[model samples]
Target: MGRETNCTEAADTLQRLREVPIEALVPVIDRSDPGRLGAWQPVIDGDFVREYGSLSVKNGDYPKLSLIIGTTSDEGASFSKLGLNTTEQIFDYPVKQILTAKIL
Candidate 1:
């Protein structure tokens, strides 16, 4: 959301947000498992890593925050040319990554 502005004060603002502490977050918990943990949002490191740091790369000093950066084939361009995009197109990569990240 941080696009460099004509005055660049906008750019500075986003950079500062990147340094903002993770909101009342519990990155280690997830409602996805045990079914008994309730609906607590999981604190995935990916959120901390990508939050606004990547979007604010124009003039900001990338913080020393640990982030898990990645991309999936879920992007639109592949299907954009064909005018069709769906989760089916991304089935393979998501499944593969889930399996691989488990071991590594």
Candidate 2:
């Protein structure tokens, strides 16, 4: 599955018909490093298609077809680029909302 704030879960459930017999991944999100994104990731993405992704087979009696889905394009890059340093900076502003600080 995923950690948090990842669209993979939604995409997996919403658009799993695209790929069959293949489960989707979580785009390898950042697990450590404290930050808004870090904190947010696990809160939501921990259950996207259950990481291994979901396997759906068409047909009741006979398994004629199977559908699979994984993290979409760009989502991986977006998730990868987002590090504690980058996201933490967002909290540095006057709000000090937590996202203002980054590891960088």
Candidate 3:
């Protein structure tokens, strides 16, 4: 039930963000603006995020549970793109590319 709510909210937010131009997003991101985090948020995609983090609690998936939530003053600071800036670059950016980049 709670998973559905979280998934719905994330999907709604992602849909709203997809309508905005990426060019407009670049400046706000470059400035590290805290208010422009909507685009950087996790979407309710079944691939990357198979289920909401809280779903385990509802489904009794975990035998033991320990939860911790942390906050950063500048959460957007970590969103710096290594080389992906242009549309072409973004299109070429795949899940493997991201994983490889992080590993390197």
Top candidate on TM-score is 3
Candidate 2's residue-wise lDDT over 1-104, tens digit each?
Answer: 23233445565744543342233332222344424444434333545433322222222333355665577533433344343244445344434533455432
Candidate 3: stretches off by over 4 Å: 1-37, 62-69, 74-104
Task: Estimate candidate 1's RMSD in Å.
Answer: 17.3
Q: RMSD of each candidate? A: 17.3, 15.0, 15.1
Error of 3 at 42 (Å): 1.1
Q: Ten-residue segment with the worst summed lDDT in candidate 2?
A: 50-59
Comparing 2 and 3 by TM-score, which wins?
3
Clashing residue pairs found in predicted model 3? none
Candidate 2's C-alpha runs over 4 A off are: 1-35, 38-65, 79-104
| Candidate 1 runs further than 4 Å off | 1-55, 85-104
Span of 10 residues, lowest total lDDT, candidate 1: 24-33
Greater-TM-score candidate between 1 and 3:
3
Q: lDDT of all predictions, in order shown?
A: 0.45, 0.39, 0.58
lDDT of 3 at 29: 57
Ranked by lDDT from best down, the candidates are: 3, 1, 2
* Tens-place lDDT digits, model 1, residues 1-104: 12222223555775754654454122322112333332433443565654444455764746667796888654343333332234564565655667789988
- Candidate 2 has an lDDT of 0.39
